[model samples]
Target: MPNAELPQAKRQKMANKTIGTHNGTFHCDEALATFVLKQTDEYSDADVVRSRDPAVLDTCDIVVDVGAVYDAEKKRFDHHQRGFTDVHYGLEIIAKRLGTALDDPKVQYVWLKLYRDFIEAIDAIDNGISQYDSDVPARYRSRTDLSSRVATLNPRWNEPTGAQILDARFQDASALTGKEFFQALDYYRDSWLPAADLVKDLITSSKQSADPSGRILVFEQFAPWKEHLFEIEADENVPSVEPNQAIYVLYPDEAGGNWRVQAVPVSPSSFESRKSLPEAWRGIRDDELSKLTGIDGCIFVHASGFIGGNKTKEGALSMAKKALEL
Candidate 1:
């Protein structure tokens, strides 16, 4: 066989680019910002130079989190100016670098997803914004967040903080943030985006079926539906009023040959449901559940009524339908 079958390391790209940022203890924002720049074709293999010297920064192709400038035409992205208000400063640059128009639906989805999930926190922390409205004590201390973990790569407060030491640590910080950034990007682009389309199809099909309420959705197959459900409903101008909003979702359970009916939450990230399975059916199971709900092939309704199981898709749909009537 040819040597082509052998596993090999990723080939390094030609070094024809330069990315500049301030030289000092690195933060998650600049570390991630630099990683985002390196992902673009123009800077994919760029050399990263950390410095605050105007002369040194001037020679670089792009500067971020430094230079006290915010000119995109000149490739400067700094947020430290007197009145900079663009929290999406980093995203704008990334989109521009990748030649993606902000108005494109897919671009908009991924941009918002990335910002909401991680980048927003980085921007907040860097800008000295509080995470909570009040100064209440946190329930738990989290040293494992990306920002906190990135900060660990910097030299200890008691340790040496030389330029060489800090720069080397910055490389490590960039790698740390880069790994998480691309993973999230890949997930949002490949998995989350596709789920939206799947949910949209399910939503459209649900209306044409026997159900007149249009509040119960039955998926042909399982997909992450929550995030897309609310958005799709709003896009379709479905009123948030009862019988118009989605109350439950029915889909086949992968583990068993049974089916599941899940209550749609009040919001995507919320635990509160718009309408739970049914108070009477809560925690009931087997034949008793079927007897109470007058639905056959019942398995169980969860204690919280968020979900219930049935032996078949029809049974699950029947459960969702009955819940709607109640």
Candidate 2:
């Protein structure tokens, strides 16, 4: 039969593509890889096939985390091959599948953001890389992370290990990962990115008029500022700002109708600040704090000197400026 003469149903069946991965135990990487691929127009309806047979993989339209091949052109994306250190293979595959250039500024931002927030941990676990250099014990243990949650979907050692059984579990794993990935995508795009722009504007304005020292920023409205503060300071496009230059951030306390002066941390992840409020003021409150700092409307300063509150914005700014001089 001539190829064009084939029936519509048979032609449609042939067009339904297959996504291949190794059969047996599944990990977060391949499950996530499969989920990402299925999101694109090209593979939105693709079937998943789990197998170790090269012949079966060759028959599929694309393969991931199997076949010992990492060629993008060939549609194979296994990281187990010798000397393969690219932990972001999933990002590349997604960019290519979406037909969006990786260098596009928006795409680049989301790429790095998602990688930092979500994808990096998965890659690290799959590659057997430790998060810390030393063997120091963690402060606490957490088993509720996405990777850990995915592992719980696998069949128990004592339970059924049939091919159909495993494939069903793989689907569940893919659904679990895909749901979280999309939620993260929505948050970064809808909320976090807008907050970054607002922070940048406020930082620039503060350097111009609000604080001549460029060491204090007063926010009329609060956005999540810590991560954005660090990111803006490190950005090469913004001029005259060194890392950790901004020492204090002042903002209104919506609930108490007071205002707050907060010390920026040494780094976004650290509990320690670049500079703390004066030692004498720490743990002081009310009239004593007002008398000690000579700033009116004083409420309290934290014991650790990371934060203090005042009844007004002017009082908070005065507190921050006084602390800067000390």
Candidate 3:
């Protein structure tokens, strides 16, 4: 009674559903798309078939990154076809049909959010869409993103083009893309989203508790605040929160065991601070900083005047308050 002798019904039940993609030179978009589809119950045990043959692809229940068809109802997801858009129409359909809670911070929500950051890049690359405007300086161009990395995994021009060789390379590409996708998904769900809530709460509280200027935010604990700060301020839903009021933030520095007063940037990613510390304190440290600032436990201020440190929370708060007056 070997396993081969099992009944046809039992064998069919145990067999994996088929997922089809192009055979040669796989890119990040398809590799990640396949992995994403596999995560769902409908394709949890899917067997990936890498081929360009119409006959082979037709047998697969779902096809992605190939076949030149963009029909969601027909289970086709190719962006190479003319008139194909970057929207994840198939995913949106699945989300709606399943009644996924868009409000909840779950996998579906994370998936949708991540599409903007990760999948959109792949779609843009596959569709030859430039991320930045055409007028952007050549020096400012970004090189070697996830798509480029995945493209590199394909067999080099000199490498053998045999079926086995191509298959092996495709497997390698799939694994690399899958790993990155899972890591990014977990990071957004576990770290980025939670930190955002905390940052928003701090921003609201700061507005209420700060002096009339409403410029300084005091954090109960240090966290990644830059991006969240800008997002919370610009959020249209929070009508009471003024987008331009915050100029500085105070938090504890874990490594140095000191408190820090940091200038908020004009924009989330900008290097220019909204309001710098006093020019006299720039690059000054310890005793010199204390004497100039007339504040005890003063550590040092950065040469750029973006940040300064103090031995106590009170000292850091004082530094920000004094800088505000200056």
Model 1 whole-model lDDT (C-alpha atoms): 0.82
Worst 10 residues of 2 by lDDT: 88-97
Q: Residue-wise lDDT of candidate 3 within 142-226, one digit each (tens)? A: 5578888888877788876877887777777778887887677667756877888898888777767755466889887888988
Candidate 1 similarity to native, TM-score: 0.84
Candidate 1 residue-wise lDDT, 1-326, digit = tens:
43454444322433357899998889998999888877666777788989999999999999889998987778887877665555434455445534577566677767777888878888788888889999889998888889999988999999988999998899899899988987787787678878988887777788788465668888989998887887876764545323337788998898898999999998889888989988999999999999998889999999999999999999998898888878
Off by over 4 Å in 3: 1-16, 89-109, 131-144, 204-213
Error of 1 at 279 (Å): 1.5
Model 2 per-residue lDDT tens digits across residues 48-82: 99999999999999998889888777877787777
Tally clashing residue pairs in candidate 2: 0
Q: What are the Cα lDDT values of the candidates?
A: 0.82, 0.85, 0.80
User: In lDDT terms, which candidate is top?
Assistant: 2
Q: How should the candidates be ordered by TM-score, best one leading? A: 2, 1, 3
Model 2 scores what on Cα lDDT?
0.85
Better of 1 and 3 by TM-score: 1
User: Pairs clashing in candidate 2?
Assistant: none
